[model samples]
Target: LQELPVFAALDLGTNNCRLLVAVPTRHGQFRVIDAFSRIVRLGEGLTASGRLGQAAMDRAVEALKICGDKLRARNIRKARLIATEACRTAANGVEFLDRVEREAGLKLEIIDRQTEARLAVSGCGSLVERDTQGVVLFDIGGGSSEIALIDLTGHRSPRLANHIVSWTSLPVGVVSLAERFGGRTVTREIFAAMVEDVAVRLHAFDGRDRLSHVLASPKFHLLGTSGTVTTLAGVHLDLERYDRRRVDGLWMDRDSVDRMVEKLVGWDFQQRVANPCIGADRADLVLAGCAILEAIRAVWPSERLRVADRGLREGILSELMADDGAWRSRGRQ
Candidate 1:
């Protein structure tokens, strides 16, 4: 165990740049040894510009350089770095990647939406209980939302992603929605508009009703893996500061989610900033995220929501360890 090699995963998304370094723990799991996250807003103005702006690229590059340093300092046995929605949509996304490789000393591949949804489900697998009938797993990002319907009826696999029955990645996200609808001073009407926008988009997905057989099961629930859901969990707990230990895997019933969203809608921009769970970094964007969440609920109503603080980085680490047969010996025991 002492000689276990380290693995790293970096996810550069539309709103944040993050990295996770970990070592294999039990089967299908790992302990994070080091991590970093910063809100670079890589998709800033992307809705209108249709290209990766110089400023957004510079901010992302700077953060990537720091991540590069962390990777260099450790003996990374395997590493997978990925760019998400922002890079996928931007016209000069490839050009920006070239700059990152040259200047930041990191190579990031833009992963498709299906891969993104799969990794998100894989990362949050541990939170799903063995008795769970099914789950509507969703990750609301800055530039997009990836949702998957996991039907765990007949066969169960250690890899949660294997049970995925259907999935879809919506182009709408907090950043894009906020940019179009105004984030800081959103009124009830504006918030509704945002929700309706995403709802309309979601209505068009064929996967929305694919898991109908298990949708009404008493044990079925919604599992959210995103900053938006985490923030909601944090606020619901009334934490003085953001605490992943308290928020991760926490359960929030339907009414609880409603109360938090309503409370957020009532608060002004500065009030949103005042909450420790949602500092200035997310004050403007939180409502936009809520809009996305609201749309998901309307599509697949679930009374309970299980919040997962983990996502792509953890998923990548799990795959890397599994690929190398890191857990085979332990599993045999």
Candidate 2:
């Protein structure tokens, strides 16, 4: 292949369905050319009912239809679609995937927790610090949070290659959080309560002295790949609208994150909905996401947190393209 063939990856999460189209470049990198995401809240009622709601499924299918159109338009050579927590927990998940494959002309893979953690690390590896002795990566999503502890000294210890020594999937997300606590108008007390709730949950996965371990290392880094961090980046930049270039790979300190949360919490739902960055789609859920971030920060008090706008979709694209060795070789040559 003279030119790298186009590839696609779709991620259907509990709250959002997203698609990305990209082609590998000569520099051993893949650049996304087009992407789409829709908030269908696929896991809207999964928390209470333990099953995906029909309305939610319909909303997801509609988003998939749009994704199908985009994939067809891009003439993608290979594509992979994966559904996360929502599908994994849904009793009718297999039935939904079957319908997606037949109706959307796309096959869906429901990945397990371990695979989810690995893929997230792969997709956001660029954000990892090279000189760090150890790093903790946490992804806060709509239905689950995946935490990975990466040992940067892995090359020194063969056993450390699988350095994700500590990994956990928290059974909470923005949708569930928002639904549990009123997302309409949050006061400072309510926000603190929400953070405390998440913190209590984190007690189950607390790493003994991970903060101290990172504090002792000069190269310690924090990588967060989730809507929460990305949205914070967007708000921090004070963007009139969402811009990935300005949001991705951005850095924010603890104080900055706290300020943003305060600003959003102070805003009524209507005011938040009016903000271009928060918009109608994310206004309600953004506060809940902020609470999750606060909880993570409380546990790991990193001065600087790196944001990763990329996640599972990029991981899938990388995997499919990697499987095609000839295609990768062609890119290298």
Candidate 3:
């Protein structure tokens, strides 16, 4: 295991399948050696069907096969493969995973909402400024959205997730929301309806008052780790092509977010597909994401939001490296 230091984390979510392989670095971080992401729409029609359809299962299995091949090719010391909201909620989720194990030679563990929230916080830990008093971090996923209210009042823990005071996992996400509303032909009215629906769901969360209290302080800001926010950041920058270095950890003010959402709402399906950052694959779904973000913005109304392109996969790698004492052993060596 010591000789082969690579670790892998695979997150098979409702809409995407992603894999990351990394080696531990200084200060409890890791350097990415390889990564893969594919929008397979594994949860398509899942909302209406209640079970994973055969086609969706097939698409997911094909993606997993590629991931399995990569894992086998590497001399990996440890790895954690996880499935999120889709697998957690789908009636045929277990059976589908078993099929994945058989066809793709991968076993995917379905993680719960709380763990999802914590992983997101862990993934974006470095992005949060040390001086910041509090943060409202959110992950808008394909099948669900996880929001965490972090309070760093007394003392900061090595694990940023330790600072999370309250968290909520909304049942609605990009895929589900788009399915609820219409995605491809989104009008201003349709966009408003989407936001209102998510707002209704957000009303049930108990952390609203707590977050509202934290918002009064200037040090508190919103941080988002998801494709939805990342895509918005990309569109806002007017990048010729999507660049992670510039997009990740970038700051967008309330007005900027509002402006971007408005611009997107104005765009037709063809216009969205023409966008370099949001290509044909994401064209239909981006507005649904914006609506989710809008609901979040309405609740907290932060002046600035820090964008995060990192999430569950990064979190998994960090935890695996820490748990294995890879950094401690390296220091000794």
Candidate 4:
């Protein structure tokens, strides 16, 4: 295993920076050997300023430096680094990235929204069942949310995203939503406003009804990949601490999700921070994320929602390995 080729994937989202280093497996998949994640709040003031703040950029650069050091420590065979919504909309995004390369020795590409949506689907592919008729997969990010309506009514392809019937990336996310509506003290009315804002944007997507037939099928469900859903899953389990092993691929029925959201809505800021699953780092932003999730649920009512902790980074690794034909020798001695 030590001698196997290593691949790296890094995602610098609006709220966090994450890295994944893995080695291809005999079955065409990859096993993570090393990983890193940090909430740098790269888009902390993006909505009001329309530019990344100096303090935010510094935090992100520091995180990227750590990632750069990790990448250099290994015999990396390939790597793909990317920045999402924050960077795409930021006026000084390119400039800030320049500083990153000069200071951290890492170059990141700002991917388009469709690409973001597709990669999210790819990352969460394993969560979908083989017999599933359809899915409305959504990734809620710090700066924007990407939704993919996958119609798997026919024979499924190896890449789940290939079956995408319609996709949309809304210019709304936890950071922006929180900053706008005041996350720390969300009243029912404030929460409702946030939901309506996102719902307006989501409902406008002409493809919102694209998967009506699939939704009518018994196998159809919602697949969510983001910190929001993962947090809800952790709370629902009454976990003493965050555990990816337990939360990832977890299924929460509609009623369970409703109860969890209601539970959070009733708590004060400190109460939210007290919960192990919603620590101080995420307390303020959790409600905003919930608002986004609620809007999605309203548009696409599903009996169940599958939570995925994996997203862009895993998607990048999957695509890179496939492109390099790492799986061609599967099962070979």
Question: What are the C-alpha RMSDs, in order, of all predicted structures?
Answer: 1.1, 2.7, 1.6, 1.2
lDDT of 3: 0.91
lDDT of 4 by residue, 45-113 (tens): 999999999999999999999999999999999999999999999999999999999999999999999
Q: After superposition, how far is residue 29 of candidate 2 from its true place, in Å?
A: 1.4
Model 4 TM-score is 0.98
TM-score of each: 0.98, 0.90, 0.97, 0.98
By lDDT, the candidates rank as 4, 1, 3, 2
Q: Predict model 2's lDDT versus the native.
A: 0.80
- Model 1 CA RMSD to the hidden true structure, in angstroms: 1.1
Q: Whose lDDT is higher: candidate 3's or candidate 4's?
A: 4
Give lDDT tens digits, candidate 1, residues 139-230: 99999999999999878988999999999999988899899999999999999989999989998998788778877887899999999999
Q: Is candidate 2 or candidate 4 better by lDDT?
A: 4
User: Cα miss at 249, model 3 (Å)?
Assistant: 0.7
lDDT of each: 0.93, 0.80, 0.91, 0.94
lDDT of 2 by residue, 1-333 (tens): 366588998999998899989988653358789999888999987878888889998898889988988887866788888889989988999999898878887788999987888778767755664566777788888988887777666463322225666676777888888888867778888888889988988888755354465555657667889988888788889898889888888988768877887888888889888987888888888899889888877777777788999898877776777677524476454
Better of 1 and 2 by TM-score: 1
lDDT agreement of model 1 with the native: 0.93
Regions more than 4 Å wrong, model 4: 26-28
